[model samples]
Target: MKNYIFCLLAIVLFSCSPKEQVQTFMTYNLRYNNPNDGENRWEVRKENVADLILNYQPDVFGTQEGLNDQITWLDSVLTNYSYIGVGRDDGKQKGEYCAIFYKTAKYNVIKQSTFWLSKTPEEISVGWDAALERICTYFLLENKETKQRFYVFNAHFDHVGNIARLNSSKLIFSKITEHNPENYPCVLMGDLNLLPETDPILYLSMQMDDSKGLAGESVSGAEGTFNGFKHDKTVTDRIDYIFISKGDAKVKEYKVIDDQVEERYPSDHLPVLVEMEL
Candidate 1:
């Protein structure tokens, strides 16, 4: 009888204990709704985008350059997921959003916030020489099954402003430290608009592990994330990234998904994917 009781207790304890969790994360730049895009307009490419996302079914994902309408459309079609973000223009639905989407059934939001990448991060304002406003959206989420909590940050850096990009990197790291007081396992992904080995990426690499470099398995897919819709094989400029906090988390695989429908690409940028165990 004592042996039976001991076995039952052991089973219960095992069941309640935290289990290692592996999740897929993706970062994509959904080019904003622009009518002048002609063949690659949002309306023409949106279905392909939806299909690709559904096929991969990332547990969590981050998007850049999505406007209010585009975000709403994605939120509607991607029924299994919900997102958190605010437009950079007015802290509402005015401009592009650095949206972070998570599977609704897998996690619950504990806290979420959005801040501009500027000297005055508390308010909505462009910083340095940026031609446009930039922002970062972050969320603290708790896994429904394991009860483990972590943070996710998504951002879009200025394409024209070198100072803005560097400052944005610093600001994001500071914000991560501020928001994650417990130093929870964190994931930062985005269209940073800076090449690898540059100052901004170098700074970020010091603080976090670039998922591509840390993947335990082989990294695969296109060498570059930006295609610019030009079928130029010579174009190899990788700017998109996924960085995880330096912790117990292990990146199992990293991939730059360059999938396209026929000869047409969904967006100007390819999506970067990572499967990690935390």
Candidate 2:
């Protein structure tokens, strides 16, 4: 009788413990829709992009350079996912968006918000010397089964302004630290457009643990993200990244997805994918 009671208690305790959560994150710069892109137009590469996402099925993903129609198309195809973000120009669909998508079946969005990367973060305004308006979108999600919570921040830094990028990094750090005080397992992903040694990158590294740097195994794949629609150009610089809040998650795998079909690539910037445990 005592043995039976002990066994039952052990089973109950095991069931009550929080389940280990493993999630995958992907960051891709869709490369703004432009008629000048010619063969690399959205219509030409969308299916391939969709197929790639469906095949890997990341638990969450952040996208940069996505215009309204482009985001809508992705919304239509990714039936199991829901996204949060606003246009950077007017905060109402007037310009490109940095969108974050998550699997709806696995998690619920408890809260979500967006802010411009400028001095006046509250309004739709450009920051110091930024060439264009930049924005960051964030999602606070709760796992349905485990009830665990986490945050995800998606962004695109200015490509033309050095001061803007530096200040933008500081702004992002401040925002993240303010909102994520509990240190909930959080992930930041985006097309940073800066080299690894840049001030912005270095500052962010101090706040978060990069998946590529923390992966238990060596990162396997291409070293760069931008391809510039040049099939033969060797990609050697990485400007995209997925970073998790320090002490919040464990990096299991990191990959730079550079797959192509028939010499047709999905986007100018390859996707950065990471698997982590919380």
Which stretches in model 1 have alpha-carbon errors above 4 Å? 1-20, 232-235
TM-scores, all models, native as reference: 0.93, 0.93
Deviation in Å, model 2, residue 88 alpha carbon: 0.8
User: Backbone clashes in each candidate structure, one number apiece?
Assistant: 0, 0
Query: Which regions of candidate 2 are displaced past 4 Å?
Result: 1-20
Model 1 residue 41 distance off true place after TM-score fit, in angstroms: 0.5
Residue 91 error, candidate 2, Å: 0.7
Write model 2 residue lDDT over 1-278, tens digit each, in one string. Answer: 99999999999997887653888999999988888889989889899999999999999999999999999899999999989888998887879999998999999999999999999998998889889999999989999998999999999999899999999889988998899878788888999989899999999999888888899675878889888877777787899999888887778889998889787679999999998887
Write one digit per residue (lDDT tens) for candidate 1, span 92-161: 9999999999999999999999999999998999989998889999999999988999999999999999
The lDDT values for all models are 0.92, 0.90
